[model samples]
Target: MTLVVFLLVPRLHLLDLAGPAQAFSTAADLGHGYELRYVAEHEEVPTAQGVPLRASVQWPALTADDLVIVPGWRGRFAAHARLSKATRAALVAHHASGGTVASVCAGAYALAQAGLLDGRRSTTHHALQDELAARYPATRVQRDVLYVVDDRVVTSAGIASGIDLALHLIAVRHGAADAAKVAREMVVYARRNGDEPQRSAMLRHRGHLSDTVHRAQDLIDARFADRLPLAEIAAACDVSPRTLTRLFSAATGMTPLRYQQTLRLERAENLIAHGSTVDAAARSTGFDDARMLRRLRSRLP
Candidate 1:
């Protein structure tokens, strides 16, 4: 089993800790061999949400397959001040030993303190990006991103971005399909990649209250790479094809097929950027041939 130790600090932002933890827990429930653990310098931990949490002060034996995550906390200066020297040393040693380390939101401060981020590209909560850069000049801070990964060191933007980071880790270890299953179980819209902006396409277009559109989107998101007939989708939603088309187009400013193609394009972009040739990316994302993928990509603005 891979051990995931969350380094707990005072005044923790609940989601920054819970989001990633929940993703991994769900992955474990889905048959991934992950063992989650919590560690803190003190037995009793206080959080900004006014909840007192308890953790083990004892550190566990770690292997290269293990991960140490520092969840973001409230009050940047005060929370960063509480990063104990021992905790910083542990982070450095773990990364030196080839174990992965990550941070969410202002938790990047903790990694910075450990000197793990020196000469690495990282990011944090948007509001804190400037300060994180100012204090850690050796670190290249990426702004307006969900997360950034430099080697085994990962850092994410504020709050819910932690979920994206965790999902990414799951994808890297297992497979994209496995991570998507966990995300579907958690009712996440879709998995966001590190390259995408903080507000990815799958998330940015979900603000509408149209239940029919939302339901269509959920189905489309789940199987975007598959062949989907509009009639089948409309029937599933108890609407005619024309009605589904009109409603979906009005709600999302794109037809259902267009939406699916958009998802395909996004995934294809990620795949190609990761060194997949056009033909391979096309086949992987369910394209009949490379021509369609090329045509779609050529239209990108």
Candidate 2:
């Protein structure tokens, strides 16, 4: 099982910890091999919301598949927050061992303290962007983006954006379909990737209140890489093909086939990025030939 460890600091923001925690917990519920653990410099820590959080003072052993996250705290200046030297060393060692190290909002300061953000592309809450940049001259601090993933280090902008960061991680580890399932179960729209205009298929076709449309979408999401005809999708949703087409178009601005095509295209692009050839990616994503894949790629802005 992959372990997800949270480094809870004093006065940590409740949402910063809860948002990502919930995302991982939901993924676990969906049968992902995830185990959540909390560690802190002290056994008991107070949150910004006045809730007391209990954590293990001792750090846990982590593997390359494990993830360690630092949730933002309540201080006006992150530089003022005190992090134990042991914790800093642990963060550094974990990254060196191929583990992922992530920070949310002011939590980036802690990673910066551990020397993980040096010469890395990272971001924090907009209000603290200047301070994070000034303090860590070697780190490139981006502003206005939800989150950034540089090497094995991830940093998110603010408190709520932590959810986006976690969902992105889930997509990277699992797949877009699993990530979308978690997002749908959480009733939250998956945010677009910071570097991509095309959103995840899970979120791209969400936001409508039609049960029929949603049913069709669920089938499409689960079997996008299969050769599913519109008639089969319509039959599964208990609607005529013409009626399903109209409802889906009105709800998501795309036909059911188009929605499936988008999912297939996105999956193909990811496969290609990870060293798969055009023909292999096309076959893997349910395309009969690379011609359609190349045509779709040319249409991307």
Candidate 3:
């Protein structure tokens, strides 16, 4: 099992901790063997929202397969708000020992203080990018990106970008399919990859709150590789075929069958990229033959 340790600083932003924590926790729920731990400079720390968080003051032994993350905090520019010397040393030692180190939002300051970001490409919240660059001249600060992964050190933009960072980690350690599963369970409409446009079919047709459409989507999500009849799909969602079609279209801008086809095409393309033959990819993705796959490919610009 891989150990994921979160190093919480005082006045931590709630979402900076919760978003990534929830992603990893959901991955565990989905049967990934991950062990999560939380640590801090003190036994009890206060959050930016005025809530007290309890954590261990002691650090745990970590290995190369382990991950250590620093969630962002408020008052990043305050002298008293800085990470303790012990915490900085811990982060430096972890990275030197080949363990992965990550930071969310202003937490990048902690990693920089540990000398982890020196001569490395990193990023912080857009509003603090200039400050981070000015403070750490050796670090290359990337702007307007969701997150950056350079070497084994990861850093993300502010607030909700932590979720994207965590999901990207899942994709790296597990697979894209596993990441997509976690994002779907979290109801995340889109998983942004740096500054790239939306690419994952699992996230493409999302961003609405229709229970009927969601029910239908759940069916397709779970059984995308199987041949599901429209009537059966409609029945599972407790609606007629026509009603299901209309609702699905209204919510996702695509018919149920089209959605299924998109899922199949995307999966098949992944398979093909990984060296699967057209016929094999077709069979794996529920297509009758390579003809349909070829036709779909031809239609793409």
Candidate 4:
């Protein structure tokens, strides 16, 4: 079982802690072999939401495959709040042993305190980005992104973005399909990429609130590499293919078939970047031959 240990601090943001936890828990429910655990310096932890939570002061045994996450806490002055020497040592030791460490929102402060961010790319809640950079010049603090992952250290923008980070980690360790399943279970329409400039074709047109369109997108995401039929997708959403196409176009400025093709093209590009031949990538992404793939590639806009 993979252990996910949450390092709790006083006055932490509730969603920053809970969002990722829920994602992993849902993945566990989907039989992902994930086991969630919590640790805190104090057994009684106070949250920004006025709810007092209890956690074990004792940490569980950890392996490199396990993860330690520090959720963002409530304070812009986190750089000044000193973590215990033991805590810093533990963070350093864990990472040195090849375990992954993640931070959410202002939680990047904790990782910085541990000296883990030195010479590494990371980010935090946009509100804390300037402060984090001012405090630690060695750490590269990025802006305008959901999250940044450098080596085994992952840092996310802010609260809800934690869910994005969690889904990303899931996709990396498992596969896109497993992450998609967890997102589907959570009712998250998409598993956003960490570096989303919000430009990826899969993410670009998901801004609308049409349930029928969303259901169509879900089906397309799950089976984008297949010869997906619009009739089948529309039937799944209980709409006629014509109605589905109109709704999808109205919501996303793209038809359902266009969206599916974009997904396939994106995956095909990734495959080719990873050294797959054009024909191999074409076959892998469900294209009949390289000719169609090449035609689509040449039309990149």
Best by TM-score: 2
Question: What is candidate 3's local distance difference test score?
Answer: 0.84
Model 4 agreement with the true structure over 1-301: per-residue lDDT tens digits:
9999999888998999999999999999988899999998899989999999999988888899999999998878453347899889988998999899999998999999999999999999888899999999999998988888787899998898888788777766654556767776787665444446423455556666899997888788778878888899999999999999999999988888888888778777756754689999898778888999999999975
Candidate with best lDDT: 2
What's the TM for model 4? Answer: 0.79
Each candidate's lDDT (Cα)? 0.84, 0.87, 0.84, 0.84
Which lDDT tens digits does candidate 1 get at residues 1-301?
9999999988898899999999999999999899999999889889989889999999999999999999999986444355678888899999999989999999999999889999999999989999989999999999878889887899999899999899777766654556667776888864444456534355545556689987887787778789999998898888999999999989778999988887677777767755689999899778999999999889876
Per-residue lDDT for 36 in model 2? 97
Off by over 4 Å in 2: 190-199, 268-283, 289-301
| lDDT value, residue 134 of candidate 1 | 92
Ranking of all predicted structures according to lDDT, beginning with the best and ending with the worst = 2, 1, 3, 4
Q: By TM-score, highest first, what's the ranking?
A: 2, 4, 1, 3
RMSD of each: 4.1, 2.9, 5.5, 4.3
lDDT (Cα) of model 2: 0.87
- What is the overall TM-score of model 3 with all chains considered together? 0.70
Off by over 4 Å in 1: 30-33, 58-66, 78-86, 89-100, 150-152, 167-196, 269-279, 290-301
Estimate the overall C-alpha local distance difference test score of candidate 4: 0.84
Lowest lDDT block of 10, candidate 1: 191-200
Name the lDDT value of residue 208 in candidate 2: 76
